[model samples]
Target: MAGIGPLTQDWEPVVIRKKAPTAAAKKDEKAVNAARRMGADIDTIKKFNAATNKAASSSTSLNTKKLDDETENLTHERVPTELKKNIMQARMNKKLTQGQLAQMINEKPQIIQEYESGKAIPNQQIIVKLERALGVKLRGKK
Candidate 1:
């Protein structure tokens, strides 16, 4: 008893209260209420809110489309063999090297090589330019 210290007691429970709204928040709420009372139509606000919600939801969604192998292969179509043959024969008849033909057509030499090898992706503009430069009917009916 002589060596014992003062006993500690539990404190009384204190009531907790939610924080009051800030001045700005109260002003904004008053303004919205006043606008509603003054017959301000909420349709525009509703539309804007709906649009934002829709855009947000769509942005978070992932594109999960399945691609077909055959369609994927067909998408990157190359120049036809007949077209390649015509380009090569025309170039030879014109006595112009690949570089010379490319320069004459205002294109790169690699482009000319790709066209002749049938590995190039067909471009109507490039074909037209080649036809004009070489005076050969490379593409079209027969």
Candidate 2:
């Protein structure tokens, strides 16, 4: 009789519960005020506002003006001659065939051969794209 009773023993499934917000969450009104001031178009404001109040308040501030100046300085530096040679060498070393390389970079096979042979100079934008695609730097006179 005892064994038969054990066969029907009740079992309950376990349920997981999430923690409730603390007291600090209840008094958090800054976000509400910000949304009100930003208006119903708050989503647009957030998207366009490059600089955020929270970001400005943080100690690690971004000096965008300084970044611009540094970028300008870097642009003026002359291209390293060795980098140009290496770019040409990399294509040859890969044994990709000029046509293959051209296809990979979305250019004509003759263009790839011309660049590799140093017969013509690629435009700045083309050089950048090629450098990234080939994983090699192609530096030349600025």
Candidate 3:
């Protein structure tokens, strides 16, 4: 649909008429008419809707904060000094500059420099990316 040509149809299709209002919708209309007859204020309806939305939003934020805390706790180990040294040595052995290594790993040159200089501690995901690109393990054997 995005990159192709327009379609040409051979024949026109038959049209269908709309169905009558459902029993649920008719019942809802009667309830609304009764509420109007009983004079339920519009301001009260607005306040109820606003309170419901606020409660839902607050709970969503709490769930998001819980997930963030969990991820932070999961990163237990920091990158070691030897890992930084290994990254720099591997880049040199591969005849690659920091920018070249960054390009290979889809990271910024500054980020690659920071990792090599021990200015940044990479997470496990980034460590795996570096290991794959450099063909060397930054993590030591157990």
Write candidate 1's Cα lDDT for 1-142 as tens digits: 7999999998999899998867997887788888999999754243455545676666555332233223545468899999999999999999999999999989999999999998899999999999999998998764
What TM-score should be assigned to candidate 3?
0.44
Q: Rank the candidates by TM-score, best first.
A: 1, 3, 2
In model 2, state the lDDT of residue 72: 40
Q: Which portions of model 2 show Cα errors greater than 4 Å?
A: 1-84, 140-142
Ranking by lDDT: 1, 3, 2
Which portions of model 3 miss their true places by more than 4 Å? 1-78
- Per-residue lDDT of candidate 2, residues 51-120 (tens digit): 6577554534456555655744433333345654666677777776778778888888877666656665
Q: Which is the better candidate, 2 or 3, if ranked by lDDT?
A: 3
Clashing pairs in model 1, backbone N/Cα/C closer than 3 A: none
Total backbone collisions, model 2: 0
Winner on TM-score between 1 and 3 is 1
Clashing pairs in 2: none
TM-scores, each model vs. reference: 0.50, 0.36, 0.44
lDDT (tens digit, per residue) of candidate 3 on 73-97: 4553445788888998889999999
Whole-model lDDT values for every prediction: 0.86, 0.64, 0.81
Displacement of the residue 110 alpha carbon in candidate 3, Å: 0.8
Better of 1 and 2 by TM-score: 1
